[model samples]
Target: MSAADVWPIVKARLELLDDARKPLIETYIAEIEHRMKHYCNIRALPDNLLYVWASMTVDAVRVDLPNADEIADTVGGGANIKVGDTSVSGGSSGSGVTNTSKAVIDQVVLDYRVDLNRYRQMRWGG
Candidate 1:
């Protein structure tokens, strides 16, 4: 299957009903596929790895397009509260944010290392 075939599955996993973010999602899908190809040394993605690719794409999208504002709105916090001489501040747990030094794409690949290994093509040089 091609990357296009995985788009719908990624959308479904992300609960996306509209196509507003289609382009963005597609971009992530391409990058994920590229990394997978490089890591596994495979020319094309096998059908068995479709769901794995979709999952990695979903994770990258979630990290890059985190719904922080929506989450904060729903979980209300007081970041500007002050009481006399004392001051108090609070904010959303920021659980949606992933604190990682690695890029989202790299992290996705690393996260799916085992799955990708199954399809890896070994190479040897003289």
Candidate 2:
């Protein structure tokens, strides 16, 4: 399905009230489609996988949202506090380690492995 077909569902899933983020969501959907093409060896995603596609897109948006960095700094075991010239920093629960080489699609693939596997095309011969 084209981004136009999937945009409304994604917007609803995200509870978005306006089109301000439409372009960003569409970008994520396109990236997911590209990665799905490579990962599943399919020219296009099957219609049955629309929900999966939208869900993955939503996840991609959430992971890369503008405020994600701010949230990461204070949540999930990463925190810093300063009081009266004294400062203390808490150790991160490994969430601070970022692998820049990994694309957001990689995580989405892991997240939806079960669904994708159901439709994965097997490749054979060199």
Candidate 3:
């Protein structure tokens, strides 16, 4: 199946977004399809699972894109920067801020079983 087939379910899962956001969502869907292709043949997977993954990936992307500016700033100089009276120094050890949405997406990608070893084991015998 294609992202176009995944679009309706993705849209249904999301909150009301403006028409301007439509293109962004499309872009995200395209990205998902591209990324999934590298791991395994998405078209080979069940349509139901594809719908679930597409819906989830779109949500993750939706949450992540808005934080793009904040993420960039944090990577740039956020550790040294202070917010209002609170010091937002990224954290001790300078690991920088965590992108939770990205973490979720990464986990989801694993759930999709894109790894060569895992995918092969899943598709074939142990």
> Model 2: which ten-residue window has the lowest total lDDT?
92-101
TM-score for each candidate, following the candidate numbering = 0.72, 0.69, 0.49
lDDT of 3: 0.49
Q: Candidate 3: deviation at residue 49, Å? A: 3.1
Best by TM-score: 1
lDDT of 2 by residue, 1-126 (tens): 676778898878666777887776687888888777778888888898898888888666555552443323332243543222223343433332232213555776667888888888988877
lDDT of 1 at 65: 50
Clashing pairs in 3: none
Ranking by lDDT: 1, 2, 3
Native-to-model Cα distance after best TM-score fit, residue 105 in candidate 2, in Å: 2.1
lDDT of each: 0.69, 0.64, 0.49
Backbone clashes in candidate 1 total 0
Clashing pairs in 2: none
Model 3, 1-126: lDDT tens per residue?
A: 776677776665554343445666777677666555555643454454566556556545444543344322332443443222222243233343345534645544555563322333223443
lDDT of 2: 0.64
Worst 10 residues of 1 by lDDT: 81-90
RMSD over all Cα atoms, model 1 = 9.2
